[model samples]
Structures are given as C-alpha cells and as structure tokens.
Target: MIHITRTLSIPDSEIQEQFIRASGPGGQNVNKVSSAVQLRFDVARSPSLPEAVRARLTVLAGRRINQEGILTIEAQRFRTQGRNRDDARVRLVELIRRATEVPELRRATKPTRASQRRRLESKQKHGDTKKQRRSVGPSDG
Candidate 1:
C-alpha cells in the first residue's frame, strides 16, 4: 500500500507496471534490458481516492491521463529497472499527495480608501507630466 496522506492509502492492485527497453544511460545493456518502467493507475475508478482528489488528479495528470482515466507515468531516469520502478511509484505518490491538498478560496476585496486615493494621485501626476510635455502653441503666454 502507498500512503499519500494521513487519510489516504492506495493499494498495490490499483497500480499496473510494465517493463520496456530503455534508450538511455546503460550503453550496450540499454538495448538488451527492459529497464524503463511504465506505470499506470486508474484514477477514475479508484476507491482509495475521494471524488475531489480524483477530479484534481485527472486535471493535474493532463496529457498523462487517457480518455479511459488511466494515468500513465514513464520512468527511465536510471539505468536499473528497480530504480525506475521505485521512481515511478514515488512520482505517483507525490502526485496523489499534491491532489489531496485543497487550494485556498479567494475572497473578493474592495480597494481600501488610502490605496484608491494613492492610485488616483499617481494617475493625476502622470497626466500632469504628459500635459507639460505638450508642444508650446503660439497662443501660450
């Protein structure tokens, strides 16, 4: 089981992993060994996740998630299969943990009187500067 937060734990059965030949770092062994790990998790149907977390996870997964709601993460950073596998699982847990956090709601706020006055004063000062830069006309005193 992978524990994402205090209240959330995802079972191993929820994740599926496939090994494929990787193209980086291993040199001659790269072509011979299937070191890359492809991990997939079904976010839409997982009972371990709350509905809110599932929705946010889908959004956070972006192109990684298919239409079937399976989130795919490919890990090939390391030359060894074991490291790649662990990396993928760690990434999945981190992603789930991020989704578990609820963003703070933004409350509408009116500009304070002081700030409004300052803004208007700045605008007027700018306008005065621009007015002084105008070309002197023949009618000017």
Candidate 2:
C-alpha cells in the first residue's frame, strides 16, 4: 500500500506501470533498453481517494490527466528502469499529497476608510498637479 497521508492510503492494485524506451541521446543502450516508466492512476474510479481530493487531483493533474481520468506521469530522468520506476512512483505520491491539502478560504474584505480617503486624496492631488501643468489660454480672460 502507498500511504499519502495518515488518513489516506492506496493499494498497489490502483496503480499501473508500463515501461517504454527512453527517448533522446544515450547511444546503443538507450535504443535497446526500455528505461522510462509511465505510471498511471485512475482518478475518477479510485476508491482510495475522497471526493474532494479526487476533484482537486483532477485539477492539479491538468494535462497529465486524460479524458479517461487517468493521470500519467513519465519518468525518464534516470537511465536505469528501476530508478525511473521509483521516480515515477515518487512523483505520483507527491501529486496526491498535494491534492490532499485543502486550500484556505479567502474572506472578502473592503478597503479601510482611512485607506479609501488616502486614495481619493492622492488622486485629487495628482489631478491638481496635471491641472497646474496646463498652459493658460488667451480665451481664459
């Protein structure tokens, strides 16, 4: 079981891993061996995740999560398949851990009276400065 938090844990059955060839430069070894790991987790169908966490996970995953609601994480930073697999799992855990955190609610606040007065005063002062810069016209008697 993979433990995300004290209250949340997901069994191995929920995760699926596929190994594919690692792209980019590495000579013959990279061409021959499949070192990259693609980790997939079903966010919509998972029983382990709570409804709120699932919603958050979907949003957080963004492009990573497909229409099927499968979150895919590709790990190819490491040359070895084992390291890549571990990296994929670590990333998945981190993502889920982030999804578990509830964002604090932001309370709507109005500007303080003093601040509002200062802002109006500042605007008036700026307008007066602009007004003083205007050239006196002959039509102004």
The number of the candidate with the highest lDDT is 2
TM-score for each candidate, following the candidate numbering: 0.89, 0.87
Instruction: Write the residue-wise lDDT of candidate 1 on 1-141 in tens digits.
Output: 988888899999999999999875777999899999999999989999899999999999999999999999999999999999999999999998999899999999999999999999999999999999999998996
**What's the lDDT for residue 93 in model 2?**
95
Quality of model 1 by C-alpha lDDT:
0.94
| Model 2: residue 4 alpha-carbon error in angstroms | 0.7
Worst 10 residues of 2 by lDDT: 23-32
Against the correct fold, how does model 1 do in TM-score? 0.89
Displacement of residue 12 (Cα, Å) in model 1 is 0.6
| Runs in model 1 lying further than 4 Å from the true structure | 130-141
